[model samples]
Target: MRGGFARPVISLQHAPDLHSLRALLALLALVALSGCSLFREPPAPEPVEAPIAASEAEPAASEPEAASAPEAASEPAETPGAKPAPKKPRPPLIRRHKPAPPPPVAASAPPAPPPAPLVQTHTLERGTFRTLLDSEVRKPDGKVVGRAVDMVAGPGGKPQEVVVNLQGFMGVGDRKANFPWSAVHINTPAKTPAITLALTPAQLQTPERPKSGAPQPGSPEAGPTRLPMLDANVERANGAKVGRVVDVLLGGSADPLAVVLDVSGTLEKRRTIAADWSALHFVTKNNALEAQLEMSDQQIDASPAYANDLPVRAVSPAAPPATPAAPAAPAAPAVPAHGDQ
Candidate 1:
């Protein structure tokens, strides 16, 4: 039995040692649990770290995107205003003006014609003698010899006698001679009334003057020097009537200045006058008692004589001769003298 008891003791001792070992193992396990609890590794630590790094990277990246979005929105707002700037308008165009033209021109005109000639005449009127004539005969060497002293009408009231007086000689004898009215020449240019004659200085000097009642041969008192009944009448080339002879105007050159004559039938009638020098014709058979005029009546009226009469004595002595005198005197009177009963 003892042996059996000892073996049981030994076994009991081994069992106590085994119990201490178990106690140590339990303590170590407790310490390990405490350390694990105090310094514990987080659940999924690498995954958590990865998530934090991703969050930081996402903020950085999102910051750039936010700034870019705002810039893009502002760019769109500016585009609308920029579009209106290009559409702004410009100014209008201008034009210029012009002027008008002028008018046309005109033409010119034409010319005119000429005038006619003049003439003179003589006639008888009242008891006092007078003459009618023109101005042309007053020039030097003119045909009319002297102014008519008296103009007497014939029985039918026609011009009958012309008495002409030759002047300038001292009355050595009778310087007066009588001419029939028919012998007077009317000068248009002379502007005077006068008689033209064929008698030269010799014939003019031979006439005898009679005392008032004494009968000189061929005189009115003794029926001497009776004028022949002349069929020819004193007339103008222009056909006007001539009246009566009055006086002559004489100038320095011995040329007849003018012959003064009276118009017939009326007082205050304009007297006819002529230049004695221009007398062209004297109606006489001998041609010795005749002078012709240069101008016609139309020419006389148109001449300066028509405006005013020229002075016969005012003619210069040195003036050239116009017409020459006849070379010889006539032989005898062509008409026969009537008997002095």
Candidate 2:
């Protein structure tokens, strides 16, 4: 009996120890459930991405094109049919011009007429000659019949007679007739020295000569009265001064042909002498005669009359020496005999 009691007791101790161990194990399981509530369980990790290669990186950069699409969509639209700008206007062109014409001419005037003749301005001096002769005689028909030959003055210095010679039968048997000075009229205007007669040619042919015893008054024999010679200076037509009258030249015994004048001055310086009757023109106012010839010193020296006998006499302050008479020639010596010893 005692041995059985000891064995039951040993069995009870062993059962209590086993119950304590089972309680400790239940507490450990409750702690594990609370940890699961505090920390969630990690999902299975997504498959890890791989790093891209350089060649494959282009696709990743192209992914930004989706962000640029919204900016392009925000741009404004363009309008249609807008006009082009107008061109600048051009400037206008100017026109050119031409010149004009001249004026017309006027009319001219007419002309005029001519003039007349003049008279000679010379006069004949008085008393230089006793008888005056007409150089020519003309008929009524203007024919020259004869020239005056000689003229004679009466006792009282009057022209008493005029002689004229007529040519008959070709100058043979010439007839000389005496006429009264009253019947002869001087024609100074004729080209030749001429005279006009109131009587016809027949009357001149039968002219009656003046009788010596007839009463001279109221008769054809009555002579021309004498006129005095001018005592004034005489100038030659060439303007030479003639001082005095030396002589007169006459065609016949009683007719006056030309005038001789003496120029006053020195003897070596010869005097002027002129013979042209046409050159004789009397200046009554100056008491001078005018000669028309232009005479030179050589011409005056060569003159026939002046060269031989100088008309001018030199007036010296003192008397000139008397010319001595030439001694008579000695009688020729007796001629010696040809056989003289």
Candidate 3:
């Protein structure tokens, strides 16, 4: 009985120690499971609703705000008497405006036309011909006889004869007569000049001038071939009519400087051009005097137009030829030396 009782007691003691170890192991396992819970990942949150576009949403009657006021009100309110959390500053509100459309473009204008060309000019010096119109006629004895009324143009547009209106007392008998141009010497100084006639006033009606009267200005002469100079047709080298002589420009000495040709019909504008007086050659065609110039249509077109107000360069007159000395009176026949005689 005592031996059995001793074995039972040892068993009971071992049993109590084993129960305490099992309790400690169970407590350690509980601590490990709580640590694992701290390390585990959390579940994902639900997605927020997307905002509606301005075009898709219904229009509001009130003034529109840049940020949604309702969204700020939906957040939780701060607690009273508690230290409030620092809030992140909201971004500044910016206004956006739609851009305006561009303006319409304008069409370009056409280019302007080119300018017209200007004309050129020149001058002459010496007096080549005499204009006897309105010049007083004086005799060799310095007696005033008559006044020259008109001139009759000869073959080359030269004055062949001059018509004179003789002065009479109180308009009793004013006779007109024709006299040779060579017979009259021009000594006229200004526009109205007096000339000297080689013949006396009585010789006017002698067979040269008609007993009735000489032809007046613009009248046809009887015997001699009289040609019209002013307003005469101007012909080109090809015998084609280029223009007409509008006027004969004279110098201070009553000499013709140039002939003004009206080339309006051949040019784009109504223009007149000046040609040198020496360059023109007069010819009789169709019983009329015509002037010819050595210029082509292209040459005339390229020339400058003439203007009456244009300034001309004054040319220096040429020196006259020296007069030959008379023969030395035959040297007096060598006046025989007294010693040789």
Query: Which residue window of length 10 is worst by lDDT in model 1?
Result: 1-10
Q: List ranges where model 2 is wrong by over 4 Å.
A: 1-134, 206-341
Which of 1 and 3 is the better model by TM-score?
3
Instruction: List, residue by residue over 238-329, the lDDT tens digit for candidate 3.
Output: 78876786655444444446676787874367877777766677776667665677666666777766654554322111223469988776
lDDT of each: 0.38, 0.44, 0.60
Clash pairs for candidate 3: 119-304
Query: What is the Cα root-mean-square deviation between model 1 and the actual structure?
Result: 32.3
Q: In candidate 2, which residue pairs clash?
A: 126-228, 126-229, 234-289, 235-289, 236-290, 236-291, 237-290, 237-291, 237-292, 238-291
Pitting candidate 1 against candidate 3, the one with the higher lDDT is 3
Supply candidate 2's per-residue lDDT for 145: 71
In angstroms, the error of model 1 at 224 is 16
After superposing candidate 1 on the true structure, give the runs of residues whose Cα lies further than 4 Å from its correct spot. Answer: 1-104, 110-233, 237-240, 251-258, 263-268, 285-341
Per-candidate clash tally: 70, 10, 1
lDDT of 3 at 28: 62
In the range 1-341, model 1's lDDT, one tens digit per residue, is 11111111234445658777677667766666666676665765332222334445455554443332222323333334465333324334344466655555555555554422233332221222222322222213454444443433332233445444444356434333445444444433233433345444564443556677865533222112222222222345454544233444433222334444333335554634443433424443332222223443444443332113232221111223358876897688666568643
